[model samples]
Target: MERSRIAVAGASGLIGGALVRALTADGHEVVRLVRGAARAADEVRWDPERGSVDADGLAGCGAVVNLAGAGVGDRRWTPAYKARLRASRVRGTAALAEAVAALPEEVRPRVLLNGSAIGYYGETGGRTVDESAPPGEGFLPGLCVEWEAAAAPAREAGVRTVFARTGLVVARGGGAWGRLFPLFRAGLGGRLGDGRQYWSFIALHDEVAALRHLLDTEGLSGPFNLTAPYPATNREITETMARVLHRPALFAVPAPVLRTVLGEMAGDVLGSARVVPARLLESGFRFAFPRIEEAVRAAL
Candidate 1:
């Protein structure tokens, strides 16, 4: 692969951090867009909330990956929290898109990979969905809709745009897996709700690889479902984790309890989405860990 100059927003987050490391390892010049003062040689200050960024930092960059956004699962879904969630993604993405659009044609990055989520599909029960599937209804889908729309400026500016509709990313260091480790180790891990709802997931390594692939593969565009080919149910994931850690998976969290504890946010944890990486697979992308058991074992 040819060495390229890549500017990445939200370089401090989980996926962003991994992407930075991956890009650096691949011999690319990485410019990190920070919110405050420049912390290092490659760091550039950018305030998305104010739509301010260093144009000089983005000059001559071959690609820009916007991973900036508020954490959806970080708190309960209060009305104010929901507004913040929507604004965080929309405003931040629009800021990057506007910055990229404002750049000179010759210096502007040729591609922009914006982040999205599989929650766009809402609760699909056990039915399998792909990139071609229509956006589902509800808060998550609405948020994703606006989030992707915020990147329209880049697309209109002739930059190839790719919206990564990510699924549950499982990693040992952080994310969902880390949060559930204690419960699983204590033998209190179990399925959420009825355990029949499908849960789409991807290994962190695969997630990183897919992003790299999107950056390299010029023909790819639009919404790409970033998930393993095989999407398992909640029960399956709990069972796999239990088996992998040598624990019991008998204790299941009832839906009512989850709703009471998590409020509207509980639907996210209990909902089912059997998402498939149709576009990715059709494009010849191979998954490192396609099965739930293998992914959980490796992650553990």
Candidate 2:
């Protein structure tokens, strides 16, 4: 593969961190967009609030990836926090999109991979959905609608903008799945709510690979679900974790308890989204761990 200079926002994040290492290992020049002073040679300072970014610094880049956003499930959803979540994504995305647009057309990157989430589809009950499916109901779907629209500037500038609608990333140390490991290993693990809500998941390694795949594959735009091929229900995940860890899965977390603790965010916790990576499949992308057992065991 030809080496290229790629600029990335949110380089401090899990996916962003993984991507930077991968790109560097593959012999690509990776420039990071940082909020504070440029800490290192490859970092560029940018403040989304002031609509400022080192556009000139990004001139020669071959691509840009924006994963800047606050954690949705990180804290209690106060009205203020919700606004922060929206602003963090929409404002940063708008700024990055505009920055990518400001580059001289001839020097502009070939593509812009914007961060998105399967939350765009809301709760899908038991029905399977893919990129072609229309947006579903709830605050998340509406937020996603605005989130993707924020990337219009890049698209208008003739950049191939891709909305990577990510799902639950299963890993050992970070993300939600990581938090569940200890509980399940101690035999205190249990299903959430009815344990029937489908959780579309991807191993962390696969998630990173899929992002790289999107970067290399041309003729692909719009939303692409980054999820494992085989989605498992909450009960399935719980059972698998317990089995893999040699523990007992004998408890259940009721919906009301989750609602009481997580407030509005509980809906998403108990929500069902049977999402599949249809676009990626059609584009010939493959998953490293497609089954729940394999995915859980790998995490352990």
Candidate 3:
């Protein structure tokens, strides 16, 4: 498919920054929606909290991707922080959806790839789940439901809306894996909790590629799991990291310790969601690093 102009919200984030670089390197024009003033040709000011966006800036774009949201693991799960998490995702998505919906048909983007997460499935334990599975219980699941629902305006306006239900992004720089790299390098890395909870992870390289696939593909709409085919247990992941980094995986953080240290967020950290990219695979998307070892090496 030929590259087209795409507008991206949260373009400063890990995935968004990588996506922008990938798109631009491939000759696609990208316009970023920024919270600050538009100081560059590629930037457009937007405030999701106030529900304001420069619609004129969005005009003529072929696609819009809204990845605006608070980093789930960036802080402790205090009531206020949890509220910010919900507000950031739900409000930002709603604002973007409304902006796209208000656009004239001639200039409206064809597709809207809104940000979502596999947390919708809650704690799937050892059981595997695809997009077909219904939502599970808890705060994360409920928050995900609201996050996806906030994009209804775009879908209702006949935009080809898709939810990129992302999994644990295994990257070197910033994410859950970011904290792991230093520890493992110092030979202090170990499994969290019982280390048996399943973790569905994807390489940063494949995550960007999958997003592009969703953006460019035709006749594709709805939720797609952006995860690898194989789901590894936390213990397996620790072993892989140790083997790859030549470190010993001798230590383990018990579940009680995790709860004490991470507070409410510990539940999510230890929760299992054995997710698979069923819809993405069915859509003919291919992953560059599908295995745990490959993904871990790629991150390094």
Pick the lDDT winner. Answer: 3
lDDT of 1 by residue, 1-300 (tens): 369999998888888999899999989999998887997889888887666778778889999998887788888889999988887788888988888998999899899999999989998987899998999999999999999999999999999999999998888776677788788999889999989988899998899999999999987889999999999988888988988899898898899999999999898898899999999999889999998987887676
Task: Select the stronger candidate by TM-score from 1 and 3.
Answer: 3
lDDT against true structure, model 2: 0.89
Order of models, best lDDT first = 3, 1, 2
In model 1, the Cα lDDT at residue 87 comes to: 76
Candidate 3 lDDT, tens digit per residue, 1-300? 478889999898888989999999999999999998999988889987666888889988999998888899998899999989998889889988998999999999999999999999999988989999999999999999999999999999999999999999999888889899899989999999889999999999999999999988988999999999999999999999999999998889999998998899999989999999999999999898999999999998
Which pairs of residues have clashing backbones in candidate 2?
none
Clashes per candidate, residues 3 or more apart or on different chains? 0, 0, 0
Highest TM-score among the candidates is held by which one?
A: 3
> Model 1: clashing residue pairs?
none
Q: Assess candidate 1 and give its TM-score to the true structure.
A: 0.97
Count backbone clashes in candidate 2. 0
Listed per candidate, the RMSD to the true structure in angstroms reads 1.2, 1.2, 0.9
Q: Cα RMSD for candidate 3?
A: 0.9
- Write down the TM-score of every candidate: 0.97, 0.97, 0.98
